[model samples]
Target chain A: MSDDRIGVRKTYKLAIGGAFPRSESGRTYVVRAADGGFLANAARASRKDVRDAVVAARKAQVGWAAATAYNRGQVVYRIAEMLEDRRAQFVEAVEAGEGVDARAAGALVDAAVDRLVWYAGWADKVAQVAGSSNPVAGPYFNFSLPEPTGVVGIAAPQESSLLGLVSVVAPAIVTGNATVVVASELRPLPGVTLAEVLATSDLPGGVVNLLTGSLVEVGPVLAAHRDVDALDLCGVPAELVTELEQLAAGSVKRVLRPPAAALDWRERPTPHRMLAFVETKTVWHPVGV
Target chain B: MNWEYAPAPESRAIVDLQPSYGLFIDGEFVDPGDGSAFKTVNPATEEVLAEVAAAGPADVDRAVEAARRAQHETWGPMSGAERAKYLFRVARILQERSRELAVLESLDNGKPIRESRDIDVPLSAAYFFYYAGWADKLEYAGFGPSPQPIGVAGQIIPWNFPLLMAAWKLAPALAAGNTSVLKPAETTPLTALVLAEIFQEAGLPPGVVNVVTGAGATGAALVAHPGVAKIAFTGSTDVGKGIQRELAGTGKRLTLELGGKGANIVFEDAPLDQAIEGIVNGIYFNQGHVCCAGSRLLVQESIAELVVEKLKARLQTLRLGDPLDKNTDIGAINSPVQLEKITELAAAGVAEGAERWTSPCALPEHGFWFPPTIFTDVSPSHRIAREEIFGPVLSVLTFRTPEEAVMKANNTPYGLSAGIWTEKGSRILWMAQQLRAGVVWANTFNRFDPTSPFGGYRESGFGREGGRHGLEAYLDV
Candidate 1:
């Protein structure tokens, strides 16, 4: 496993457009290991950082979305490959943060990688699986296609830090929607490391912008932000969900209310679709023209 | 809203609805293959309402086969626009004959006239109208390209809201292009039978929507019917479990809206007067026959006595009598059996040391009736507190802290709906998060809209009805 000491922290900044820069907020929050050891301080993304991520996402999304579903599938597959390559680092991070056994961490890492592959496989086929044509009366050719809801803000699950973050973010991005993921409060190292993988993979910058901070601090900000069209509240605290729901209600943004029970990260496949995260615009032109 | 006697409409002896009613199947009313029939009593008068057909295994088979035949060619291949027009016709006829439907619903099902008129009829129309819109918009509802209908749906509706339940179950199934074999509860079969007439009048294809009647045996048969591809039931938790167990090995899709013992919490800071009104409506609505009725009341300890005082005063204003009366607030128990159950549970509450109080309301001698009941000094572990009595009964428990209120509110296994009464927006938000119930009503209770998802948790059941989520129940995900 490559150690953090080997890579070393050069600068703490927001990773936008595949480069690191100080957050527009010029603020940082220190992350710590479960044992109270200090991890690196992560950038506190401001509204500007969110917008920058959105801009980068807007730039990359067209090309990424226009890429053949099969090619998009391959890019997602690359993410899984990189994740599997760094399996040991993830295992170690989960062990240090969650205080779990090496055996469980190993299984979690395998499951997380397997989840990535599962979603990657669906990148090309979700359109076929979830969209449909209706038996319209006239020759107008009415059909429904699942589209990405656009820029989503996710509060990752606290317990299964990396895997939970991946599960939520993968579905949004694989469906062609960009995301800003708020990493787990108690465990943040694995999340940042996973971000590093996304930076190197074919996944364009701003497709996923990872943040590490107190959920209470950034959750409402992201939920209330108008630019984010949806909120994937997979791991929010029960006491805060209603507030987030109220905030999300302001813009009528879609909110996938958090699951009542904690996630069983190992068993379920995270489904991802290019269409689920983006809207389809069907243009009609006369055949003669 | 005090209980007042209204004479039954001059006998209607001239219009003798046949003593024996048959299952309305394959576009015509027919006797069940099994020669069984159960007598339904008018809960208000204890008179034999009618002898309703008790469907058995053979009857279920016949209905399923009929639906299967319809789905194969007649209904299944119809264009969405054509089906939408049929639904629009049905919706129109429903509005045209809503008064008749509402009167029968109140008479046979024992819900108050106001609710039957204001809620049941309108909601039924809204359901058909809502689903009617979806019929043309099916391709846009997110089912895969070339999404096809799952064949026959075997639906079992509860007694409480007979026609509304049927509307809820059938509207989506039909809109999604599936035929159905629906079994309304034994006690309330009239409205569903009338609905069959409406379907026929709308020129709906024969066997498209078959209405059968019976109790648990019939429901079991419908659930086990192999020809049916999906089962949608709205009933008790016990019956829901039986259906779940029966469908375990079979790959048939199932959606059950089961029992609930929801919490109605009132904080000290709430508008006490409005909270009191919400409390009465929560527990006393429809004789508390509602699945999402707020049966448990958790008051802040300091305000418990004050709330109880206000509740008793409000209870006086709740009228109880003939369900057909527009002014009636509470109505007769659906049946003698249900009334007996409520009485037995209330007796148990008293015997178990809780203070049982009933409003000073007069009761008629013949029919099944229960005054709005409230029990104080109740513990969370009490049977009355935990069990779904499905009657006009409320159990009062007190909490000290915000955390304690949340703990008490979510302690029950059922999670269908809950009510919160507080002025602080932050407190409402905090409490809404902590509560596990599916639909949380702030400062209100027993309110429903077609756009909101409604269901429950734990033993209460799974799968939502209404909203975008409701589409998932009918669609193959």
Candidate 2:
């Protein structure tokens, strides 16, 4: 006996303010598999979408950063767990997006999950490693601690679809900064799937708003937004990086320049990424009865 | 029952000023390539203190070359322990000549002798002492192992705290094993030049620290110099932004300490008397030229009227006179241009419908002066409340609760420093956490230490200037 059935496809949309909505411009672009096969259509985010995402991120930042470090760590760890549970879906997306073999795709997905876990562990320990209690030369008590730079704008890496996106987004959110991420233009399905994982993992909405579209269209808007405190240009095209950086300077936004050489996402990450988006605040009080 | 105090002026004989001064390059005083010169005047008396050489682009090039050579040949090759010794020697020399330096600072910069003698000179010396010890222990600074110096540093400082700002820039650069070409503000180059003599007396290596004096063009030349691996600046936000834009894609390291309009919040349950003293010190210190000066006072609504009345009475008692007078509390404005700017901003406050109260203080006969003034009924949108009025002017805004106070304090683009006055411990902690500023003072105001890191968030600028974090600015991390 022969059976015939139709497979239901997922409509990949931009995640803004906890809801998956189509682009405000009402546009969608076809995303192709690595072998040029037809894949799902992804939302083509516009400048309006960029502004909306920044607003959401700004609204979410105060509460997210106000959450206890331990609680934030738990929320981040839960993201890894949810991503782990949806491993096969990400493996399939990575294989299609990166044109890698099944084994390599599986390895990338696993690295993504482990990267989230690694960053989650840093949520509570970063202050200890980066902060200090100064023995000031005075009759006073002084100490410095790290606070999150609010509302970061991240351009996810274009090539390493899953692992690179995870690598950049995890460190930012783990340090308590809400992020408006511009996912890979050509390969965005894995990023959308990861957004779904974040949504279900108890992570607050607007904390991680993912947008899939043309970087050229939205990169400058994100860079020049006065409300955005920092920019991570890890995924911006080389030709456009300088322009985006110049725009970021208009507001004196803290900019993280992209690597000069090709980066290996599977390598062990450093604490530098987490420290990049944090501001050091020193407090002084008189030591007296 | 009017009583007057006698003038107790500090002796000027301690500073032996030269008729004309040249750029200090390669441990020697040399004439500028363009031979252009400018007169340094005492803002308090309008006397031409000295004729100083104005460095052009060519002179900036010479200074950068000298610093680069020094870094590669001497400073870099030396061990951290050896470097620490030189820094210690410089610190000792500064302390030994503290009186002369302080007197010169008061004459050239127009700040009171009391502040120059006690706050500026001592803090300058303390910075060298603090960073001198960190010279050898950088590996333990938690920036990974074997951090390397970032070649030559190009530093430009504002006129507000001339010598102290120089120390804030150079001590860390030198301690981190980097040579520097420093540019002092045009109006206040005397103290920095005097500091060069101290460096020479201490037997510091030639070109390890070079002083090039000029206006903005010379600073632009130094900033754009390709040989400089880092640029550290403390000035207005506008110029800092220009420099930040100019350095795009060049990959040179940059750190900025820029302008701020800090909010000093007062709670209802606070120690009222101490809070009054802190409120006065926060804004009037340094004649309000400080970058982190608490120019905005946020008093809770319940005590706002009482605090304003008390502040007015306290203002009347502040003596505004000659900077050399030991009894002077408020000194002359730094320059005529700054005085005019302050006048214009204060006028705007009046034009914008805020009530202004000027202290009953007589002005000096021949110098720039502005009385200690405060504006009540100041809305958050007022120009005097928002823009940095780097003069003896304070804007008073009232808040009803802690949340409203935090909201108003963090509303500005600049986040440099803030003050909180309350008797409650948990409230202080909570307020400190809510503020977006770099430095927070609880039950006190305008307190600084070499061991504390100082910088700003947002447009106020990035990177730190003191403590262990300051070393990162001069190192290739």
**Which candidate gets the maximum TM-score versus the true structure?**
2
lDDT of 1 by residue, B1-477 (tens): 434555443223323366788997888889989879998877888788788999888988888889999999788899888888898888899898888888878778778878888889888877787787787677776555556778899999999998889889888888888999999988899889888989989999999999889988888888888898998889887777667656643557777688899999899999898899889889888899999999999999999998999899889877777777666788889988898999999998988889998998888787889999899999988999989999999999999998998888878756677888888878876676556666677776776655455666444566667655567677765
Stretches off by above 4 angstroms in model 2 are A1-4, B1-3
**Structural similarity to truth (TM-score) of each candidate:** 0.67, 0.98
Error of 1 at A129 (Å): 16
Each prediction's whole-model lDDT (CA): 0.77, 0.94
The chain A TM-scores for the candidates, taken one by one, are 0.86, 0.98
What tens-digit string does per-residue lDDT give for candidate 2 at A1-289?
A: 3366667799999999899999989999999999999999999999999999999999999999999999999999999999999999999999999999999999999999899899999999999998999888777889999999999999999999999999999999998999999999999999998999999999999999999999999999999999999999999888898789889889889888898898999999888888889999999998988
Q: What is the TM-score of chain A in candidate 2?
A: 0.98
